[model samples]
Target: WDGVSPDRNFTGIENYTQLFTRPELFRVFFVSFYYLAASAVQIVIALYFATVLSFDLRLRNLFKGILFFPYLINGVAIGFVFLYFFQDGGTLDSILSWFGVGGDHAWLGDPESANTSLAGVSVWRFTGLNFVLFLGAIQSIPGELYEAAQLDGASRWQQFRHIIAPSIKPVVSLSVILAISGSLAVFEIPYIMTGGATDTSTFVIQTVKLAFQFNKTGLASACAVVLLLIILLVTWIQRRIVPDDKVDLV
Candidate 1:
């Protein structure tokens, strides 16, 4: 049924079929890959920072607040801020100009680089949350373990590999699940920044457009359901592969 029509039509599986058959479906999922890659980088950066800051560091709390501040900002506000940032001759361009790079390039207008630019924003905003998670997990490890490892003349890397990593396996697993799910459901950033234009349309943004912009409520609902099932399947597969066994930190 069209979104505006009150007449209810029962078209069983038709919406699903249409959704799956569209050529745009492949592109939509492909766009999600950029964010997925960004999420991986975000995790690594977060973990690195978390590990470093968990130990003694100068003004660590201030640094943590600076990193996490982006996550706390309103999405709309961040979107507008980045719009200015990526616009030609904008802040990013000015900074790059210092290194002999030209400021004439359009960061968000080029289809080739649009998704990458948007994904970078995602990494900037979400890394803080992941950092906090890793930091907490690392801090919770028994201090005695580190002391024992140091007594054995274990290097920093050895202490991390043997103690920190094993103790934080659960948080790492959780971060992976969240990253995958969040990557698939990315909406607000691309929606507000690019309006899903320039090949930056994500699955969630496409669904919103189908429902509201195209008046394809039935199809949009099907897309939403499919997204949910996809997320559930991914979570199930991840759980099966990474069993939730208790990590013995001995």
Candidate 2:
């Protein structure tokens, strides 16, 4: 379905102004950052694994496939998986209870734990696919670069520092941009799992609520336009920092 379920009145940029009036805008921005930060860290971890795995090894392809498993599944399905994990008397709480520090906790229902739980699930489901992307990028570089670095008495860390990292900077930049934008647009996982209630409602999730639940289609459209602009602005900043020369687009 289109993100815009019902074409409503177009209010031009006024929808953008309403976003700041909400008291929870700061919290909204903070929760969104949680998603972005977690995703970025996950991508870093994935890149590390990808770099290590690029070397010849047994079942390398299988390992790559397995790593990317989470992304292939639907986002809503992934959300449900996490939903079950955090439910009262769920697997995670049970395990924690065994460790003696567990209290009766409602993961999604609690304000403090709720946003973090959603962000963590998002990272877990997504990072591997970026790993696969980075893997291909890391492997595509000519071996001569590494050879030359080694010939210059460069260490593995050094080679990665200058040769490997610079070569893959473009991929890293792209991944970061995707992470940030995706974090802002997040809806399915949060909405399905938490229903975006009790302060877990992100901007995009709130937009959905506005349209489908509240029938404020115009406001929802406004939220979407604001989100789009936010994404565009963030992307522009990233591109400015990384620049075209850093990334090997060709």
Candidate 3:
């Protein structure tokens, strides 16, 4: 955790070269699929609720508070809570049993399900932030546009497609950026819930393990740098694809 240790001293470039030669390096990317899945789910949920439910201020506030509450809770605590929820005969299993499924299934114990469970938790926790962002974007659309659309006998779906979506293109782009970066950097939930076990290990968790657990700070630094570059590269690519909305002042 500190640069002061003599044993942790090593060249990051060399560490990078050495680390990539190992076969387990690809496992990091494999586990990172969870992030991709969670981000997509979050975006869809955020948009749906923002568009369909934003008009009901009282109900919207209630739902927002409930959904956003998870984000307010400490990451470590969230991990613990979900860990118990997914444990054998725990809340999740109880609910599943009600639906006549998940009989004797160990959600976190199974390599196949562990990362997925973590990803679902990620969506549950972070979707609320995006919901608010989309909600604000929706609210900012001028009432006149909706009124005009209404006069034209435009359906709600058409109004959303033509007016709401175009007006909030910038916010959507911003949400995509945040979602991708946040997903790539995910660490705490997986760390506390699974301890990088059962193939639920992520890039950030691996970096932490290399640094603190193995005292390979240089290699860990290399991993951190690689992850940072991946995020930057992906963000750059996203921006290129969905350039920011430009306003004409002239």
Best prediction by TM-score: 1
How would you encode candidate 1's per-residue C-alpha lDDT over 1-250 as one tens digit per residue? 7777889899999988887788876468888899999999999999999988988889999999998998999988999999889988899999998999874788898776899999999999999999999999999998999899899999988988888888899999999999999999999988998999898999999988888988888998999999999999999999999987798865
Sorted on lDDT, best first, the list reads 1, 3, 2
Tens-place lDDT per residue, model 3, 108-132, is: 9988788889999999899888888
lDDT of each: 0.91, 0.80, 0.83
lDDT measured at residue 116 in model 2 versus the true structure, 0 to 100: 84
Q: Which stretches of candidate 1 lie over 4 Å from their true place?
A: none
Runs off by more than 4 Å, candidate 2: 1-14, 24-27, 98-102, 246-250
Q: Could you say which candidate leads in lDDT?
A: 1
Cα deviation at 206, candidate 1, in Å, is 0.8
RMSD of each: 1.1, 3.6, 2.5
lDDT of 2: 0.80
Candidate 2 has a TM-score of: 0.87
lDDT (Cα, tens digit) per residue for candidate 2, span 1-250: 2345655455666655666676654246666877878887888889888988887788888988878898899998988888899998898888898889668678888777888888888878887878988998889888888888789999878977887788888888888888988888788998888887768888887777777877777667767777788899989988988795754523
TM-score of each: 0.97, 0.87, 0.91
